[model samples]
Target: MRNRVSLSNRLKKVASYLPENANFADIGSDHAYLAAYVCQNDPNAKAIAGEVNVGPLNSAKDTINEYGLENQIEVRLGDGLEVIRPGEVNQIVIAGMGGSLITSILNKQKNISLEVDRMILQPNVDAKELREWLDDQNYMLIMEEIIEEQGHIYEILVAEKCNSHQSPYSDLEKEKQLYFGPYLLQDRNDAFMKKWGGERDKLTRVVEQMKQARQMDRDKIDQFINELDWMQEVLNNEKNNMETR
Candidate 1:
């Protein structure tokens, strides 16, 4: 077997967010499939595949060589953004990673803000933290997408560097937008609603459990109840918007 693997339609949808004619980098590129796809599909684009782990790095190198794209795709073995020199690529795609790891990578690689034109990120969880990090760094949220694949919902964020803008949203809007994506809130897609609704239901169960536990701290129980309420309100708002529209 020649290391058989393929990109899912969801990954392709994330790749579609990249601009045409852009130089791109895929950080943590395990098999280099996305980089190869971009190079073959977009004539004006070039890509770099950066992998930190030895196994994955070798796999990426083999994939690039097998595809005869050595000239179009550069494979480097280093952590996060360390593989790419400043200004080497305009668009950076970091996917298949946890939200906290992704945020930490971006936080440590602040040089990318000055070097790259845009960032396309797909976080596995804690998307609110990643969005809050982007807001703190003055990055503008250009687009947000939620896709369901293999019975799971993934959020992809497309952002651009910016210096002047109001905070991510008004105080209430910020909380709701961070928990549910800003664009997804406006789009009100089925996947988005389903994901948030499921989360709300889970939180409701947790709140009920906390309330019934006689030993539970009052403060902690109150906090859980508050979160459950917020999630319920947000979900209801999304549902109402969808129905009216």
Candidate 2:
């Protein structure tokens, strides 16, 4: 029987960021499945599976040991980059965490953050905030992916510290690219549209409720309207562009 380690589409996409033979770390590594999988597939690759909590730390160890990858992949228990010493790895992956927490992890560990050449991030929410934080830290957005699995839409960002700090937006509005993702905007797939379309519906409902309320907050209503308008316009623009082509 083949020993198989399954990765969700989101994680599989995350794994694609790794080079042929990478020195990598997976922070918030829930099961260390990604790390173990990569090491097993690429014999030359080595990985650190870092987990802050005991439950996940134990899971990571079990997975690595099950794969007999103890030599190639190490399971470390510590918060964020605290598990990763500077120069230990060339690529870093932080997945299945909130954007703010991801930013905090990178922010709190300057030494480890500066040592890596690449970063692969999958923020469950608040991705715009993460993009902004990456911009400030001089990480260049090199690739972006939007994947839908089990009815959930996940976005992955692959960046590098070539340190140019150049905006990837290419004449597009910075605010729009930050909120909507620069590469994702250019590659508006079904998952991306569905995610923003659902957001638009939710915002529209909330705006309607505010209008129907006996007491209305003008500022909140205006904010929701503005967001709703932006989403609708983008969706329409995509539609128009597709039609013209």
RMSD over all Cα atoms, model 1: 3.0
Give the TM-score comparing model 2 with the true structure, all chains together: 0.93
Model 2 clash number: 0
Measured against the true structure, the TM-scores of the candidates, in listed sequence, are: 0.89, 0.93
Best by TM-score: 2
Measured with C-alpha atoms, the lDDT of residue 158 in candidate 2 is 89
- For model 2, the superposed segments whose C-alpha errors exceed 4 Å read 211-217, 242-245
For candidate 1, the per-residue lDDT at 47 reads 92
Q: How accurate is candidate 1 locally (lDDT)?
A: 0.83
Query: Residue-wise lDDT of candidate 1 within 1-245, one digit each (tens)?
Result: 33433678778987899988769999988699898877777767889899889999899888878867788888888988888888888988999889999998987888864458788999988888988988887778888888899998899999888768655466757776787777887787888878878987887788778778869778887876777777677678876877999
lDDT of 2 by residue, 145-194 (tens): 99899988899998899645577965658888898999998889999999
